[model samples]
Target: MNLALKDIRHGLFRFVLTCFGLGLLMTVVLAMIGIYNGLVADALAIVKAPAADVWVVEAGTQGPFAEASSIPPDTRDAVARMPGVAAAGAITYQTLEASHAGRTLRVYAIGYELGRPGGPEQIAEGRGIATSHFELVADRKTGLLVGDTLRLGRDRYSVVGLVEDATNTGGDPAVYVTLADALSIQTKLDPAAARVQAARGAEPVKRPTVAAVIARMEPGADVGLLVATVRQWKHLGALTEAEQEELLLVSVVDKARRQIGLFLGILLTVSAVVIALIIYTMTMEKLKQIATLKLIGAPDRTIIGLIVQQALILGGSGWAIGLALILTVKDNFPRRVELEPFNAIVLAGIVFAVCLASSGLGVRAAMKVDPATALGG
Candidate 1:
């Protein structure tokens, strides 16, 4: 008795094809949403990996991640002497390109005190750097496995461990080494360049510096008060774990987030337009049936229900298809794609509302089709 169901069944093949095409569009929309979530997660990965209570950097700067910060390596020992500081470690950061197995990989280099506050929280394979020098803990994304040795700077390092999701805000996998090794690589002069400089009566610059000094507070210690005390030091700046995350999100990845949001907005708008046009055309093709129903004294609500029902069916089916498509290939993306349950549910609600709203166009056109059209046909 339902006109929409009857018509859809009569043209089932066309209806399915339409849904499949619409599903591809929905998949694109869902992928955009996943990409934005992934961007935020990726940006926070390394920042959250270290289990430190507070971060201390150079004075007058938001160093470590947001900006360049080079503090005396001894700062770690000094910070450890402060009240309420249980432990401290010096950490350094830099970007380096290395080649392995005929492929070049961009890596974010992190130097930290061994067995300290700055090491990765979780290791998926092997063990943390046990030998100190020339032993590295690498993110699995770097395509390096345990026992695999790669060259960085002038030194060769063996991959001793692999960590998951340990990448920097820039989406490069992180490689961890001892503070001493990192300093040597980052600050050491190239041998050829050093010789040229020496010939010119210049000494190789060797400033012992670390990007930041990380501190862990004792049980029930006040992080705010500790940060305040650290900041009182003329040569130091400090922030809590929360503040560090905020700095990365609000400053480091802010532009990329805005760009992704704008792109998502455009895709949603286009989806609405496409849905409206599809419903309108489908309604146009059913004009004769609409006129026949009107001639038989069917009420306006019944005609409206027919168009709305068809629109919902199409949208619901498309959403399902899109979900499948996105899941099948989500892992294939170069960057991470995180599709959370909350986001998917929220998108579903919006899609349903759009479906109902789009049906209005079809209902309006169907209502205007004169009953006299049935007589002519």
Candidate 2:
């Protein structure tokens, strides 16, 4: 007795085909949203991984990630002695193209104090770097497994451990090694280059200098006071963890987020137009039936119900299909795709509202069908 159900059943194949196509489009939209969320989450993971209270870098620069930052390797000792500091460690970072098994891999090398504040917090497999020299902990994404040896700069390193989700905002997998090894890798000078510097009466750059020192404040410690104290050193800059996260999230990923948002808006607009046109065409095909119902005493409410129900069915089915597809293939995506439950619920609400609003065009056309038209047909 329901006009919407009867009409859909009458052209079930066409309706299913149309819904399938719309579902594909919806899947893309959902995936895009997930990808954007994943990007932001990944960008913040490096900052979160350290679990530090404050980061001290070279003055006037955002440490290690956003800009060039270098500080004396011994800065950790000074920062740790400050009143509110609980622990401190020097950390260094550099990007390198490493070769293993005849294939090249790009990696972000992190130098940290072993068993200290700046080292890898979790290892998925193998053991943490047991030997300081030439031992490395690599993210599994780098495709380097335990016992695999790779050449970095002028030295060779053996993969000693594996870490998961340990990548920088730039999506480069992080390779962890000792602070000394990182400094040597980052500032690689050939013997010739070193000899030239010595011959010119310039001291060869020292072997071990770190980029930054990370510190954890004691419980109830005042970050403002600690920052003020560190500033007096004149060679170091300090940032609270929250400020570092904000710098990476807002300053590093801002353009990518905006670009994704613009794409989402365009996709939503296209979806609305497609839904509206589909409903309008379906309504046009049923004009004679609508007129007949009008002549037979069907109320305006019944006509409105038919259009709204059809729209709901279309949108609801599409949403379900899209969600399923996103879940199934999300893991295979190159970059992470994080589809949270709340995000799904919100997108569903938006799609439903859009469908309902779009059905207005169909409702208007249906309401104008003259009762006399049924007699002519």
lDDT top scorer? 1
Error of 1 at 158 (Å): 0.9
**What's the true lDDT of residue 65 in model 1?**
86
Positional deviation of 96 in candidate 2, in angstroms? 1.8
Model 2, position 20, has a per-residue lDDT of 88
**Residues 1-377, model 1: lDDT tens digits:** 88889989999999999999889988998898888788889877777777888999998898788889989999988889888899999999999999999989999999999877898778899999887699999998899999999898889999999998887877788999988899989878888888888898877756779999999999988899989988898789998989988998999889888998898889888888888898999999989989999999999999998999999999888888988899899888777888988887887888899989999999989989999999963
Per-residue alpha-carbon lDDT of candidate 2 for residues 151-243, written as tens digits (9 for 90 to 100): 888999999899998888777889999987888887768899889989999767655678789998899999889988888778789888999
Clashes of each: 0, 0
| C-alpha lDDT (0 to 100) for residue 182 of candidate 1 | 95
Model 1 misplacement above 4 A: none
Instruction: Give the TM-score comparing model 1 with the true structure, all chains together.
Output: 0.96
Error of 1 at 206 (Å): 3.0
